[model samples]
Target: MATNLALDPSLIERAVEVSGEPSKKAAVTLALKEFIARREQRRIAELLGQLEWDESFDHKAERSRK
Candidate 1:
């Protein structure tokens, strides 16, 4: 998909610097990905203390065994 956008030059410069992305496109992609992840995290936060877990399972031990 091709879209034409008139983005601010300074914003692009700052995004590139902060994100460490090689190009404007990459910086924008990273920004969007992070934004989506943050939104998803918020949704997950809403589920906190509402989910059931196995009391006997040690997640850290399983990962170490793997």
Candidate 2:
């Protein structure tokens, strides 16, 4: 897909240096991918303390039983 948006020159240069992607396109692509992955991880982290755990469940013990 081809799309155009205004991007910061310095950020592009820094991404090129850090990612060592050899081209602006590659660097931009890698940066966007990493950015999305990091955002998803942060979203998942926000759910860390909201889940209920079962005190009676023993996953390791179940594995050992096998």
Candidate 3:
């Protein structure tokens, strides 16, 4: 999709320099992907210890059957 936004030129330049991306679009795409992955990791981290475990479930038995 073709979209336009007023972004900080200095920040974009810094991103390109630090990321070593050849173009502004590449830098922005990499930044967006990293941002999304970081956010998803944080979300998954928040779920830690929130799930119930089945104490009676035998993993060895299941593995042996197969």
Candidate 4:
């Protein structure tokens, strides 16, 4: 995983400072994880109200079942 790329130095510095990571690699890792989580959350958000709900379903009855 020893790859190099032309990344912005200022952005990297800001990420390190804001994330309080000890090194650029740590900051980048945290940024990538957060980016992935945010994208997944957005995808889930987009699914809101897209599922069908049964009005006759009784949650209390289901919970009381042995």
Candidate 5:
């Protein structure tokens, strides 16, 4: 899928410079991939943390019921 959207030229310039990708498309792709990976990592960490909390709660509840 392809979409067209306008962005601030200054931001695009900075991204292109830092990425050294020579093209706006390449810079945006790199940045978008990094952004998605970071979000996925955070999400996985959060889910694991929640699972740990749930297991701890289950153990506590079981002990109290005995």
Candidate 6:
């Protein structure tokens, strides 16, 4: 599969240099994959945190049941 994306040249160059990949394409692919993985992990954590019931909510329910 082939896709065209326009990325900053300086950023791409930095990724290639740090990755030490033989080609720019390889560096870009690796960088993009890592970025996506990190972003997804953060999003999942945020969602999980939001789903958890707060202590205040639990206390309120206990009081109401008394």
TM-scores, all candidates, are 0.69, 0.82, 0.81, 0.85, 0.67, 0.60
lDDT for predicted candidate 2 compared with the true structure = 0.94
In candidate 6, which residue ranges exceed 4 Å CA deviation? Answer: 48-66
Cα distance off (Å), candidate 4, residue 40: 0.3
Q: What ranking of all candidate models by TM-score puts the best one first?
A: 4, 2, 3, 1, 5, 6
- Against the hidden true structure, what lDDT does model 4 obtain? 0.98
Residue pairs in steric clash, candidate 5? none
Q: Local error of candidate 1 at 22, Å?
A: 1.0
lDDT string for model 1 (37-61, tens) is 9999999999999999999999899
Q: After superposition, how far is residue 18 of candidate 6 from its true place, in Å?
A: 1.1
Of the two candidates 1 and 2, the one with more favorable lDDT, higher being better, is 1
On TM-score, the candidate that comes out on top is: 4
Q: What's the residue-level lDDT of 63 in candidate 5?
A: 81
Is candidate 1 or 3 superior in TM-score?
3
Give the per-residue lDDT of model 5 (tens digit) for 1-66: 798888999999999999999899999999999999999999888887466344445666778894
Q: Which window of ten consecutive residues has the lowest lDDT sum in model 5? A: 49-58
lDDT of 3 by residue, 6-53 (tens): 999999999999999999999999999999999999999999999899
In candidate 3, which residue pairs get closer than 3 Å at backbone N, Cα or C atoms, i.e. clash? none
Q: Per-residue lDDT for 38 in model 3?
A: 100
Q: For each candidate, how many residue pairs have backbone atoms clashing (under 3 Å)?
A: 0, 0, 0, 0, 0, 0
| Candidate 5 Cα errors over 4 Å, as ranges | 52-66
Per-model lDDT: 0.96, 0.94, 0.98, 0.98, 0.89, 0.88
C-alpha lDDT of residue 16 in model 4:
100
lDDT of 6 at 65: 97
For model 4, residues 16-41, the per-residue Cα lDDT tens digits are 99999999999999999999999999
- Candidate 1: list runs displaced more than 4 Å: 52-66
RMSD of every candidate to native, in Å, equals 3.1, 1.6, 2.0, 1.8, 8.2, 8.2
